[model samples]
Target: MTDEGDLIAGRYRLQTRVGQGGMGIVWRATDEQLGRVVAVKQMLLHPGSDEAVTEQAVQRATREARVAARLKHPHAITVYDVVRHGGKPCLVMEFLSSRSLAAVLAEQGWLPASNVALIARQISGALAAAHEHGIVHRDVKPGNILISRDNTAKIVDFGISRATGEATVTDAGAIVGTPAFLAPEVARGGDANFASDVFSLGATLFAALEGHSPFGEVDAAIVLLARVARGQIAPPKTTGPVTDVVLAMLRNDPAARPSMRQVHEACTAIVEGRTPELPALGRPTLVLPARRPRKRVVVAGSAGVCLLATGVVIGMSLAADPTTIPEVVSPPTSATAATTVASHGCTASYRVTDAWPGGYQAEVTVAGERGRRLVGWSVTWRLPEGHTIDDLWNGVLTRTGRHVKVSGADWNAVVPAAESVAFGFVGGVADGQPVEPKLTCRTP
Candidate 1:
């Protein structure tokens, strides 16, 4: 609705449009009061959308401004103010003169696995802050991820994000995200959760590395259904840690993935010169409308017997199956736990918090000379289905289906000998139910 030299909200002069999207149009404008160039986003108000939806959108925008204004991370775009332009809403944000992930993909083809991991971690860190404040960003795609002129990653687009459990404004919800990045649950007509945001993060990273979605389609509903019912996944050709990390995050089983903190660590590990091992997708929590009835395949040459928890039965290792995944074994769990070993008057401990949807947590703590001579150490665990690797901290690493591993700085990079170094890992689980931590670590 704005044109060249249009004065917006009586104070900002509109210039050329810097960007536009499903939610709104972003224009480069001049602040008459400050006489500086700025970016203003005029939000769309659809006729079909109701008052509740519009209110929800405004509330969400306010919440996003609250976070974006205070967030100083280089990977996040800055927000300056909120105003109503011509009876509609307008958001003023920092003008980065940046290229989007979609543009980068188009111009550069697929990026290096490490680069994708780097970007994912950056976004995840921002999301972690948002999630801690009960926010869920429903739309996370390549276009929403902006890379500044200096090439720093910036996460944009919180128009659809709402505080967790808040009623949303968009009834147009045929799944509110781009098809390639929509989470299965949201695509299946359910409320988007923090875990769902994690799923979208995984999808964005997947497209960044694979030249396509891990599921291989931009079809929204079909992709959601596939994520809910099917077990088809594979990494792209330009993969290593990238393949591992993306597959782990794009898991169909939510319980099988690491927590946001874990995902952060895994991604950071990639940057820090470490590879993460993926985990098995966890068991299904919410039954899909069309899950193929589980069949009892005979176990062949198995050293350990197949086990099932919560009355769920499994016949064989899913490692051999192409179209299906094996069920998860959830033993009686603890909400919080830490595993540590004491040696030479030094102790290294890893503690976990808020394990849910088949995810585990760890807040590694160190004491004594152990932290002084930290050598390379690795943390390994399973990533269940329905969940994706969201974040990992301390170091970047690789991720695959159900297995995840990480290496850290204090753990062998900086410490000369056996030093106790602290780190942590967290992820979104598939079950939507919180689980207890039960880690059994030993020397190999």
Candidate 2:
């Protein structure tokens, strides 16, 4: 029902339909109040669709605004605000004078290695910023990269992106993202992470340089996905010196891929005609499942992006060990309450889990706020006087006098966005009253 000249929220006036995707339609609009041009993306809902579908669409639009707002980079699109019109949410974004890189490639066939390196450099820098904030841009295809006439590239369409530890918004058991650019692990039904983004970006650049999918083109989506799942990449003939970096990204193993930061540095090196310094490939952290047919599936248009609908539940269990800290049972009411405190956009809660004649076990849970991620964390507190620390798990423990410090372990170092990681310890308590020590958390 939206058309040109239609006013939204008495501020933005729609002027033209610019683009349409599986999730929404984008428009070129004028901000009458601010007297500037802006892009407005309205959620797409089929006519006569049920209420639940419409609600999901609205949530997706709102989430796009929130997730994109957390990232600030020159080569990334900026989200201005989320406005509602006709009972649906619309995302107001910075307007760019450009066309999609996909469109550019379709017209020009392919670009030179130097030009592709420049574009990749810009996109990698923006993606590096997103990763630093604990955000994974699941879809990094050419359709998501906009190229201006002047060759300035901006990465857009974070509608399907997710933060570390954040809950999945879609239904259960759904795998989203364009099949052509999906990393082998994702195509093999593994979860997408920071490394997945690296693979997708590499696939994007490979497509731009090769003028076709690195996995080869196919008529059916399933067929292309099957090829992607096999993890065999066609070598690049157009890209000369850039070939090594591109192939490094297309490695079958996710962990074997260099990080976006390293990719950016390598791209910068390629542009400068210097020898790129990349790290040795590491072992893949993900194990692909055995091949099998999937029941539920969804595929988008030619330039379709993917979505997911799965949740990960984190839990811990400990056995009774007299020498080590055991699980919390029944503690005194006064010591049962958890003390919650916030630090560096993360929340830490301390609670006592078990108490014996002269010893007690306690745990501290550190959770990152929505859209925030913690690479590593350290919690510090002053233990009761005359108390000696005995044991700890899920983190490294150190004591200096009455002060105790616990840092995350290799297995549980990163606290995903909207996710929590915990560490527990047992210590000898003072003879008198059971006093809880205040917890302070720091993240980097």
Clash counts for the predictions, in order: 84, 5
The alpha-carbon RMSD values of the candidates against the true structure, listed in the order shown, are: 23.0, 20.6
| Best-matching candidate per lDDT | 2
TM for every model, in the order presented, reads: 0.57, 0.64
Give Cα distance to truth, residue 135, candidate 1, Å.
1.4
lDDT tens digits by residue: candidate 1, 2-52: 688998878889878665433456788889998888888877654456878
- Angstrom error at residue 327, model 1: 24
List residue ranges in candidate 1 displaced over 4 A.
46-72, 171-174, 218-231, 275-444
